[model samples]
Target: MRLAPGADLPVEVLERPDFPVNRGALCGKGRSAPALLARDVRLTGPLLRDRPGGPLRSAGWPEALDRVAAGLARVRAEHGPDAVGVFGGGGLTNEKAYLLGKFARVVLGTANIDYNGRFCMSSAAAAHRRAFGLDRGLPFPLADVPHTGCLILVGGNPAETMPPAIRYLRELRENGGKLIVVDPRRTRTAELADLHLQPRPGGDLALALGLLHLVIADGLVDQAFVAERTSGFERAREAAMAHWPDRVERITGVPAHRLREAAGLFGRAATGMVLTARGPEQQSKGTDTVGAWIDLCLATGKAGRPYSGYGCLTGQGNGQGGREHGQKADQLPGYRSIEDPAAREHVAAVWGVPAGSLPGPGKSAYELLDGLGRPGGVRALLLAGSNPAVSAPNAGHVTERLRALDLLVVADLVLSETARLADVVLPVTQWAEETGTTTNLEGRVILRRRAVDPPEGVRSELWVLRELAARLGVPDGFPADGFPVEAERVFDELRRASAGGDADYAGIDYARIAAEDGVFWPCPAPDHPGTPRLFLDRFATPDGRARFAAVTHRPAGEEPDAAYPLYLTTGRVLAQYQSGAQTRRVAELNSAAPGPYVELHPRLAARLGIADGEPVAVTSRRGRAVAPARVTEAIRPDTVFMPFHWAGAGRANSLTNPALDPVSRMPEFKLCAVRVEPLRSQQAGAEPAGADAGAQSAGSDTVGVDAAGSQPPGADAAGSEQAREETAA
Candidate 1:
């Protein structure tokens, strides 16, 4: 919270002790959030473009809303509602996420709706559902970390991404608990670990399999627990038996002895846990990789017990809540499957709509973006809170698709990379200017209170949605009592819609949240206090037994080839967030990390004839990105690292692979293959910077190779309005 002496004076931000999750701890990003409230950097009015490739000019709210509504409505009328896709962000409050899903399903009648959270935790969610029949980042509270006897932190760097959360790890060490960190780099969190295993990028599956193999060979498996509380251990153990420690060592670049030591520490602990993050959850085989880790927990009797389980560290602020609601393509409110009849009826009844009116499941996030501007695909898109142009895999191609859209509407607080290419930009309020609820990584629902008023021209997304719905001839779709934008009113509706589903919150309300500071979900009734820890006695599955998945290690989608010889991995810097849309605006954060740079081992830099701080052109099969070389011994000699926060030539995602995970549909953002060269001449400097090279020869009309190594069709002009309308009728 901040206190101001006067309207024109500066404000002071103080940590709130009342916030149960953070516990009066604020990270660098949280501390610098106040700087984003500056009126100059914030978008205060709507901007509209007359046509594609036309100039954008300021417009009144009515004209802007009318243009957006009419554009989307026209597309819906011509090609059916499925022709218009709705894309959302993980940062949206639970109210906005719920309403966005409702707007897409009820008003727009489109199933092509998903959010950026697909990239954040879809793999973990998928694995959790497969084993426990439910997904929450942490089944137990974060406070349990210190009490656990052994903690294995896999592919997450909380020291930079979540500073407040790092306290738990430190406390674990102080309490005589062992900390084993697995990452490619010696991150700040890894430095505090008793054992740090630096595996090759995208090799987490192999590493986990080796650990399980060693555990089983050493007789560390809990036969009693596996026989009573789990199924399919024999199959999982059989799969692990083939992956010996030496074979995994060859694949992961980790020593066999180190693997055995780490496995022994975790398997022998009284209370052990394994936690994963984006590093393992953003691969082409992310779902199976996560399943492998969960199998280890199940075999060792670590899961479904106090202070021990497999969990994911969610990236975005409200990522867990955002995905639980209807924003995800395959999900309805309360984390219910969109294909389930009972789930559909429950949510539809709350919205006063027929269950049959809901569209079937559509494409996932990356698939939706890839389908833009193609024939028989979505022609118009409505995006909110995400900047895929910079954060998405194969970002150069994503930017091209945005340019190809007939109508691109973006709602954001700033002119982000994605917003810059929008046909209409809707200025929206920020966190301090609105009151809403968000679910943290631990499934704790916390209230975010408004501390100040938004600028005059800015409005909430709820208001924008309500006004747009009325303009689209669904004036009664949004309720009058809270349609124009009230957070608590929307939350009340959410509670009812989530009554009996996987993420039940029927008993939770605004007043209860305020009084309790924060409450865990599955509060089915007001008389029932919120569940702080789950699966203490039984799993959420129908038979109350966890399932083990038989998974194996596989090469990444894009492996090092003769042409693209070195591996490229992308991540975040301490001072920046996912896309740097808001963090870059803060002068303090900008000063800490001014731009992107390519980090490579000194030997690799020497082989390429590139010195520290020299310009390097990194070319992948999909695109190219240019950044200054940063020679460091911390990284592997065969790999290069870059932070994916900046836009344009420095954007690391420009050269990333868009290989989709088979089940999760998450793009392989963690690792890809690229060739690097030191800049030599002016002609080389003038080459197309960060330009996407489609997987086709010049003048060829064939489909290009997508992230999954499959050839998809080339872009085609959308159907004519008259032709589309005939099909619709």
Candidate 2:
């Protein structure tokens, strides 16, 4: 139940059931989504620049499209297909995402096309594919979470990060189910856990190995299941036994007694599920760590049951769907391997392109950004719905290279930090003013319907890309005579591409979507109901058996030392979203978390003579930033937490290290050594007075510390230092 545009209503009245609910009810953040659609700063028309520093003058759609086509053609002709890379984002609609891959493979003849999802979820995807022969969220539906005897949460902070999923956790708790949480920080989710194991940062693999060691040593492993349903168990067991409780304790900082207790409880449970997030997947050895986590569930025979399996809690809005539809660097639609000849042939037949038209797999996100500004590197970049300046690891280097690009194109609803630097800014429609489908963490597909018209000049990404294709004279482009006019057509194309594959969605149609609020994938035919679980009897592999990956613990690429004695981990706050492009503009949300601040242990702060809300300059080997201190017990004494939303004054990315995993190539955004110092008297007088004043200054401007030592104003300094000090000590 949603109200039409211009329907005046009070907040309290809208909250009542008597008044119409907005699209089956919205969360606090969802309720404010309508305001994002009403922003006037949207880029409606395209603009072109004659020179690098020239002003961007508005041009007709045809002119803008022609210029883009000509520029791309020239780059390809002069350098090569690899010279022009396509960097996509996870926020695009399913249709747009599908087309982005298609455009890169068929039209550009370049395999150098990858989405931002590579940076966010590639490690989890790679690990799951290696272990389970499948990469969907969980084997069972999200509804089954509440029925489990025990739930093991690793790395993730679902209590604050994923509010929608919290309902199931609450239901499970009400039903007397046990919750076990493992993280370096005692996050909001940890507070709700019956048992919480605070492991050291980048020590997740060691903890997982220790749990497996205890399971096997105590004779808790399911021998029958391992013998019949898994491979390589003997080797995995050997690896697990190599890391005893004492060794794990030394590496992970978790007491050997506590780990054994948690292991006993988990091994004895009749049914259990394991969930992991960035804490496990944002490391230099992320893939190996995730593999160890999956191995634990398999060893205990917890997968493929009603409420049991290993799950990766994805971060992006459409992270699952984006990877499924060939937006990844080495994947075709349907989770098919890009290097597999048969899979490539099948996709080529459906797309009506030459078998060899698709270029070879491209470089990962870290490599692409690192290559920028180097010899034979990317001269231009087209950013779709991403703010690399604030989100990318080693952001100082990324920002420097971004400024060196010959051309930069950014497409988004608002002027994000990345967009503010674009040579051409294209205004796009927001979610509330568009219609499509998005696959959530549980693999449930839901409709994204438009309740109001887009603001003046704003157009759907589909419309913008289609116009560009026509201008570029792309062969057999979608009908140019008129607009697609319907979102269902694009979904149908995705359905065709995904048929008979791991992420099959052929059964779901627009009519079914309208009739039902949502449906899960593997909906392979019109009459078939969606599948809620997968691999119940036989695995998806040729042998119908799950593989046991032998995993080992490895230290993070960067470790704390004498100069930088604390590990800095990056994450999101409850009140802010990624990069805060839209949420920061909301007065209420902004007031809740106005700016960035470092969360440190009170003991660490006291040692450095830093008070709560004091300004502290946090510097890594790669870069540095100055943020307000937040001494709290949420983190360990030798560890710190910082949000990655802010940019100018104290962006987390600036202090992040960019060392990547060899397998997944995901940057180590979670663990990096940093030195924190109280800003001196000279630095304390350099800050501007207000938010607007600070933002107006460049990223290099001096930021003064307040009396309490926090950023001058607009900085978040909630909670007390005593709690942090006591917890750390």
**Each model's TM-score?**
0.93, 0.90
**Against the true structure, whose TM-score is highest?**
1
| Candidate 2 lDDT, 58-159, residue by residue in tens | 555566566767777777777777777678887777777887787777777777778778778778888888887888866677778889978889888876
Cα lDDT tens digits, model 1, 120-155, are 999999999999988999998998999999999998
Q: Which parts of model 1 are misplaced by more than 4 Å?
A: 1-12, 479-485, 681-729
TM-score of 1: 0.93
Among all windows of ten consecutive residues in candidate 2, which has the lowest summed lDDT?
713-722
Residue 195, candidate 1: C-alpha displacement in angstroms: 1.0
lDDT of each: 0.84, 0.74
